[model samples]
Target: MNKVKVLVCGDVEGKFQTLFSRVENINKGHGVFDLLLCVGNFFGDTDEGLEPYRNGKLTVPIPTYILGPCSAVQVALYPHISGCELCPNLTYLGKRGLFTSSSGLKLAYVSGIEAESDTLSHHTFTDKDIESVKNACLRGQTNFRGVDILITSSWPKDIMLGDKGCSVQIEPNGSWLLSWLAAQVKPHYHFSGQEGVYFERAPYRNHSFSGSTPEHATRFIALAKVGNTLKHKWLYAFSLAPIDQMSTTHLYQETTDQTDCPYTGKMLHPSLSMKQVRPSQFFYDMDSLTDEGNQRKKARKDNKQQHKRQPPKFDQESCWFCLASATVEKHLVISVGSESYLALAKGGMVPDHVLILPVGHHQSLSTLPDAVEEEIEKYPLRTSALKKYFKKQHKVPVFFERNYKTSHLQIQTVPIPHNMAGRLKRVFQENAEQDGLQLDELPHHTKLSQVAPPRTPYFYVELPSGDKLYHRVANNFPLQFGREVLASEELLDMADRADWRDCKATKEKETELAKAFRCAFEPFDFTL
Candidate 1:
């Protein structure tokens, strides 16, 4: 097997002489060390400290990869000579780029610390830096197949506290953005500096990739600053065979056993670990349930003998789709109508699936006033405009309104191929029949507007052809039944994509989707 012996070190802080001596002795003893990896702060604390290496008075003995431009001088000089040899056997990895050594081991790095200043500094990584890494991954330049090694300056956020018994005194010195990117890249080994300990985490598998075969587990190591007061060993070493040379059997044998994390003391599963670090926000509107809301809750609890319960008044603060909530993702809003708006479905069943919702919170479409119903029906006309855009024969819009509980009323629109129109309705009808509920078709305006008492709970499906509507009224209906049918394991076989969590992508992909939909739906926007 092709194997490379690597010597990894923490922030050098201009300890090149000491670092060189250590590498020399270790190479002499082992006779297998091929490369020296420095995790940054390569130059000392002062300008005078870099003089020896700048003047060639000191030299790097082995092929060295420095994850920096940590010093002002190095930073100024990097723009011209990045990716070029800085000195004998020393190569400067650019600010943010991928590198492959002569031995064929691929590594990618992002240099600099997370800083508070707006101006770009020598040791600062910015939002643009994060975007570049994401774009590279999306463009396939970095290839989703895991890098052999990943080098970054600051330790990943929560790394220390994430494992069991790990010290929290270190503070959360790592970047949340970097932690997120690392999850996407799924590097085999992640090396970082700026932390105060020589900590090596047990490997954890990443399931970010979509295929059946699992990606390799990642081993993370954080190095202490070199020449610190305690004189912690500034260097760390590990051996890894070239990915191409490692057989399936050999790779499986090398995998880390899933066990409790040494730092957080939690079970070390990648999905669970990623959840702890994911940057996405999910909001449940507790503030909306004020004293009045509480009284309603108590009243409902007290009125157990009542056959029909009155629904609580709509609170804009608690609605996920309301324009008033700061948590609403404005980017996902394709267009706004006077009363209703079109927005991309989060964790959509397909790329073209969307949600049409009222600007204000309503318990269900059936309870909406007559004027509101007329305006909301136009949502189908807007969705139909996307037929040519999505290259589908027509769009199918489905709405589920449960009056039993408080919820923001919204209609779901999904593009379907012409051929699947019959099967789509049949599947839903069959599923409803299995649950002993009869299907009924209701006209958009008359169904609820003319009812003696408003229908509290109902589901409406407007098929692709647009002539027929499938309606069902029930005391209970499966939640998100529309999405489940479109992403059904038996029909679409995409049940896994039913949940947004399971189909999460990098921020870049989300932005791209939003931008595309916004442009496609612009002409049909009622608010315009």
Candidate 2:
């Protein structure tokens, strides 16, 4: 059970020493780890002086391997500096195809020559993008120990002109590069060039190493002796979507400051905003008493009166998913079906949202069949996926969901959470396992459905009852519900009182549930 750790490096040489120190410190007696995986960028352009380190010839004690594309051709074509091609370590790593050596250590490569083309100068590289790729690779290694060898593609740096048209250049080196480099050289070691600067500038810049200092270099070396990996562990991927698309795993914002934008405010698609509406009021239609507005206005007034009369906005029937106070947002019936309904409601449509509901008066998931349960589970995740899908497939982000009329179950819909990739990847991996396949070696073109066909609806129901019912109805009632064809009344009845319904309601009651259905709901517990 080798506790395999990966060292992710970028174009830095000095950091490798620090990386070794850190690895030695943490892994002192932990013989569980047998291999050190270097994701790439062990030495930078200036470090051609270390050319002798390549080809299983490095002075480092551990058996080492470096895998990467032989950029000799690219390096010759784009030589920003002299002797970069001769860097023994880079040449050695470039030829190994990013795999393990006969002796067992892993070596990988990043196309530094191509990277040189991407950046302003050979001496400077985007440390952040390099780190991002490295971190992701390291995480991939963490999942499986036998994956002692891993390789990552080169990270391209962007050199764009600012608004003022000044030749502003962004560069990262010293500690930032060193830390990242050291991490790659040795899996453990604290490397930070500009701790505050790295974080503060991260949002605005695409590269990581733009802020490194000599002071940080000294700290990097000292930390290396003590084995200190930087505090700001890099995440391989980040969810650009706001709160709804974000999974619980994301960095949570503590303040409700406007700077947090989508992270904290009401759920909205990334593109749409409240500012688009002129002189927008929070509850405009609800205040008007006209024919159309009267119903909405009366609804709001009734909710207000109820708030004044009752202990809280909703004792039992606030939408648990969206956390919408039915008393607040003016409701819009986006779609209505005999068995399910969609509503667009918001407290203050700072960002409008979508809501989905399995109609016909059901409150619990237990009433759903496995298929329905499955679909319900996919709802929020799919919502998140659709956001990414829309961005990828449609070039736009859309919000979707149906409304559950004044019910305890609030199924508010927004974009999916960001962490869904991990879950979906897991599902795909599991399916591959059943088929005796490996996820890592799987081709990118391999379709997900090919791996895990939508889980077949769990059970058959003579009547619309059980968790399977929701799946059946949600899938457009392709199955028979009762003795005859599917009936809306039967589905509603199933929704209200099925084995799964009790389970779902109980789950909802326990946890202050999120709108996304994919999330687990805690069962309500009484303390008194």
RMSD of candidate 2 to true structure, Å: 23.5
Residue by residue across 499-519, what tens digits does model 2's lDDT show?
111122222322222233112
Provide the overall lDDT of each model, using Cα atoms, as 2-decimal numbers. 0.61, 0.28
* Alpha-carbon runs more than 4 Å astray in model 2: 1-3, 14-16, 44-58, 67-91, 95-110, 113-150, 156-528
| Candidate 1 deviant stretches above 4 angstroms | 47-57, 69-84, 115-118, 134-143, 165-169, 253-528
Best by lDDT: 1
- Model 1 C-alpha RMSD vs. true structure (Å) is 12.7
lDDT of 1 by residue, 1-528 (tens): 778998899988777777788888888888958898889677664436545665888766788888766545657545332345667788777566556678878676888876554455656765545534433332212223667788998877655543554543556466766776676666778898876677777676554345477556678888888767887667898899866466667554444344322222222222222211112232111112222545666777778866455645556675566777865878777877677777777666677667777887765666777667677777655354444445442544444333333366666666655556667666666555543456665554446534424644555666554433444444434333455556643355554344343354455676688788897767655567
TM-scores for candidates 1 onward, in order: 0.47, 0.22
For each of the candidates, the C-alpha root-mean-square deviation to the true structure, in angstroms, is: 12.7, 23.5
